[model samples]
Target: MPDSTPRAPVLQMPQVVVDMKLPQIRELATQLRFAPEEGRIWMDERRMVLVHSDTFADLREELLASLGYEMTRGLLTRIYFAAGQRDAASVLKRLGPGASLKEVLNTGGRMHALQGYLLPEHVGRGLAAGDLRSDDYYGEALWKDSLEDEAHVARHGVGQHAVCWNAVGYCSGYLSYCAQRTIVVREVECRASGGNHCKIVAQPAAQWDNVEEDLRFLLPQPVGRRARIVAPVADGGPTTALAQSAVTDSRDDDRAAPRSLAETAFVGASTAFSVLRHKIDRVAPTQATVLLLGESGVGKSLIARQVHRRSQRAQAQLIEVNCAAIPEALVESELFGVERGAFSGASQARAGRFEAAHGGTLFLDEVATLSPTTQGKLLRVLQSGALERLGSNQTRVTDVRVIAATNEDLKQAVRQGRFREDLYFRLNVFPVVVPPLRERRDDIPLLVQALLQRFAPLHGRGHVGITSRALQALIHHDWPGNIRELENVIERAVIMLHEGEMLDLQHLSYADDTLSTPSYFGLDDTGQLMINTDYDFGASQSPASTSAASPAALDMNRLADDLLRQGPGQLAAMERALVRSAVRQAGGNITRAAALLGLSRAQTEYRYRKQQSAPG
Candidate 1:
């Protein structure tokens, strides 16, 4: 049964305030840089491109004809939404500490106007004055001469429905980023819809009456089945909303109550993350087993959780197991339950992960490490949904969806006979590759903000901020260890900072200036990666004297004389001393010390051991 009664609109526009009167907004024009010599325009570190209104209108018409109206709107909305998120990250980084929430939100509006999208004027009480998480909180704005609506109406006749989809999406994205929650913005009145001016309303997504209907244009079409919004009963715990299907549904009251901000939300707005998100949305509804392939510490566990959260089984248990952490002999007992007296230490019957995860999901990380015997049992359970307990002939049945993840190549393992081919196919029903952090450098700023916000509160450090130079260094680094490495670096930097102190290059472990590969790469105003060529490599020379005049500053003749003054065995002693010094400087890490000394880890260890055993 649907609620057929009509409800009043959530917002009504009040007297509009002039944009110039707003005192909270930062001047965005200063951040805008132009370099005609290099033929580039930049807004902070982001590259900006200029597209004519007619050209955009042409593309919109083509997309509307080809993919249809709803999809075109959704596609354009998502693009601007990502743009808004990137802008939020830039503002957060540049604002430093002690910035009010009002200032941030106002700056976002000003930024939208600066980009030639719309001249936004705040109507009704502004968003910053109220608590964003409150149920009654609502925001309204008037867009004077919206570029989207003006171009849309010029290309095609005035439409019945509001046509400013990009403006709605950009507002939603910008507000959501600043709030750290999902905010939905709708163009209630548009010039294309015969309105004198465009009027937009915004509120948290969960507060909307028909959230599913509002979000339909943003996601891809589902393969099968109508969309359903499942709102779990929360016992003082977290809750998530089910995203609507790609196609629209005519049903009423398809509502979900999504929580404010959660730590589990996907934080990155980069294209790589967007593609990965689309793949997850497509596969989450199905009961097919998902194989998450990625390098270690690439957030596979988080992806597994995301899949479960978005699936029909969100309310059920999600059992996670690190296959590599468990010993080979105990792997079977852990995955499948053991009956009483099943083994020497078996005292009582117990349910395995599959039983625990009945009507839910089972995330098996490092799944390639399972032995042949265990792999065979896993195959049987996956195929027939039945398993036999250890030391027992009785069979048990459990309904569970499995999502397996691994850094190793399963196909290569199958070819080498390390993993079963049958089991591999069973789990590989939907493979999603999570890209490494280095491939998505645009996400670093957002990730940094999220990490800092999460870490600062835990350590009781109020308002810990980072320098722009330090953040730039982070964006340039090659994160071989992926997100995990980034987390370690940020956490270490946070720990080094004093209470209320800002994080600088000195606090970063990897950003030390003395290192050979210093964190000196930065993006110029033209958005080009520029190396800090001005860094002085000549350290041993006197500060007041030039290297040309001080030829003996690093003279090998003096070193040879010193060696000659010592005994014949001085060379070996010097070599041992250098290895020891490198190891000490590397904080006892033999691998890093080996890198410092330009030797293999084994070679470094051998030399270190020989020197240690030979007398002081």
Candidate 2:
């Protein structure tokens, strides 16, 4: 059985005696570049010097030279050294009878000057390896050896021991030592491996700033600090003429504010909106192409307009193009003007969007939808700042600011080969991402009020106020369609409401009903589709029974097998069936159809479009 008893604590020793070995002492003397005759060793309670008689004067001179002071009477002392296994017993044997051991030990072990030595090759190798394990091991060994010496001193009740080193330690030991409360000695580094030579660093126990200043003085001067200043100002107040000139300069700056893009831009108080505003203001004046990114209905076009309005070419026309709305066949001709005889429909010459907006700004909305050929032309225009009209050899030089906006992730599109990488980067010089309305819901009330005022007159209704309950509901509803959806809702409510009427729950439409229920639609345990009919679809069949037959009941594992058995139109028929069932169960209400399918109105509409686009 192993012993479970705790080990006894060992006494810690000072490092002075451990560091006084012949080899280490000699190394220190060599580092200091001192002659052998100039130094002496003492061992009798550290009071008696072991020096040759001829070198006594040399020893005294060396001591004075190293310490920057002369050694006088009482400076040297005798110390006791033990002769046996135990340090206490050895000290008693070394000190002769009638000699006061305590007095000798108390006055021994004092040196005016101290130095540390290290090899550069070892340090460099350790650093190059990226790990300082070897260096740390060396430092720990030195510290442990010194500690043993300290223990020996305590056992004998002799003089105290001190350990010192140069800035170069086994690794970071020097820095660790400096972090401690007590500093034992001065550290120095010998940069002999390189052009740097041995240098002394005297680190005192206190006043670290002075040590830093000393290091600064030793290092070579930096170029920046060494550079001379050509201009100097006298300490005096500016003359009256100079003050008047400064006032005139201030007026001129004010007059020049209108010419700057940033000066005319709007500032928002909200952090996200303010950052967007600042980014727009900063990038507006530059000719660099700008990309505006955001979700649908986030006012990306408004930001693009701001970019064009504040730009240097604001005086020229601002041409707008919607890539998603334009037919793929006409996109190329629409971008680069078509010649009269270029195609059957071209009876007259017409300038393209880019040509019309030359020397101004060209705003491309839904830019991700641009065809590959048009994208190539756009890339050329960005790279060369020149474009050739269709069926024309003449290349027209354009000074147009290109600001493109997209609801889709263009980088992802680029990776998918749906967009050109070179064109994406060219137009992405400055990207301004507009925050979704849901993210900045605090602006919802302000936006609603503004829209209410704008649309009330058109709807032939006086100002309609929203009830507190209605406003709270609006805030809670996740406006997936964003501000555009909010505008449409307010407009519909205003048309239905009488003048001075407050909008209530009847006027509001909430989108969170389907999102709030987890069982409505999600994957089940077997990776099969699951649906809950408890949601208000007004279905004739009970929710529990209907849910069992819904898509959620279909096994996805068998989907491939099922697809092989069915025709190509089977998937389309399934989707149509689902939509028809949802709409019928909701009594043909599209809003309830959206809720039954757990989709937003816009998403439902998009799905409808996809169904129409599907092949028969």
Candidate 3:
């Protein structure tokens, strides 16, 4: 159930203090490009160019004039949300993984100050009632030369409501990036509104009062001006902008827009994906046994790695074992290790997966494949954190977190007596269902861009991209193979693609889905027949068209000549197509199709299923 009670703010009306330790601020250089992580300010030869505050102020005025208030606010909010996320990430990146949360927050605040958005005077720390990490952060800023505020004041002279739309977005984006949750910031008082300074309150999604209003600012919207795709730099570094991908639907709600938190792996924006990621992060820190359930290409292994990366045992190695790949007889020895001189060919004692994964994670892919004896042993290990070597009687203690994955239904297996009911209950303590690629279609654009970036260089193809139409086709197609299938398609295209060519429809090849609907093939009296290539393949003719031209009257020599000209592969393809056409015309009745094809019923059914079973 969702938490119903309102979560109190981490710090409300925090007291300003002196001697608050701040990170070493980097000196301003010629080029002030935002880092890819968005957490730090760095300088690169081919880096981000710094702009004067006046430039931002001018842009704000122009946007307001052309796009109106809400639209302008939405645009600027998205822009700064990205900037803030980068800035927060930059802070964390520079500080390293060991840096304290306070350091990260403070450094992020200081970076915004240096960027001339506002001077952060004070910040609030500590956790709220349900705060998972030290994520709920609050701070106050003195609006000194604030671009949005200054722009608003110049145009409408101190209005009733606050005018720091950009700043609010920046704060929300930065904090949200830091917390990995939706954090909205609102300006209760502002300098442009005749207030002394800007006072803002920040909290989680359910904690804030005007959350709907603030959250609206962080939503995504299309730009009125023509957009361009920013190619990677000469060094092959990718752009960090959220809106840089292909054209998006105007109806895309901000609440449902891409999060742009895609790390080295795993990317998506749909609600199904968002929930899956949240569940992973929530369970990663603990030593809970996780059972990942999904279809074969749903990226369960990747999720397991994510869990291990975030777990307390991250410093240790993550040992993986494919239960189905191992021979049934060797499953126990592989998992429990073997002792020297204990069995035939047991020359030396060796540690098994559980021992190797001590103090870390053990990923058992396709756990349902374990035999009854192996399953009993696994249960014994789970019940007691001890295991005996295959050839030895000594029981050694092992500390390991088990994360099991499978494409099959374990509950059904248990009911059928194939799997242990106790093991299912134990592993199902944290059940996560990884959504297939088809379910998260909104993520295709980003996935395509990411796949190209990662694969192009490896195949010697320079930075590449996809056309809009090709991307739309990819989004509409139901990916039965999921991410793995998409990656395979992209990689194959990359191999054949030219140095700088973009991947369009011509490069993408899908299995044949077109099924011919016809009973038989025949010729007309005039040796010409009608069939629409668009609607009809002329795949096969009907009895009405064939009755006049009997088989005895046809030219056998010409038929043999045609078959000889086409190779075996082509002949096979033609035969399969004809078989499919017959089956379809017969309404999928095997005996009827066999009669039409002059073949046995078993032969007809086998061929039809085989042709239909091929990937499409």
lDDT of each candidate versus the true structure: 0.69, 0.48, 0.64
Which candidate leads the pack in TM-score? Answer: 1
Backbone Cα, N, C clashes tallied per candidate = 0, 22, 11
**Structural similarity to truth (TM-score) of each candidate:** 0.52, 0.41, 0.46
Candidate 3: stretches off by over 4 Å: 1-264, 511-616
Summarize candidate 2's per-residue lDDT along 376-444 as a digit string, tens digits.
Answer: 999998888788878778888877778899999999999999999999889888888899876765456
| Model 3 worst lDDT run, 10 consecutive residues | 228-237
Per-residue lDDT value at 125 in model 3: 41
Ranking by lDDT: 1, 3, 2
Error of 3 at 189 (Å): 30
TM-score (C-alpha) between model 2 and the true structure: 0.41
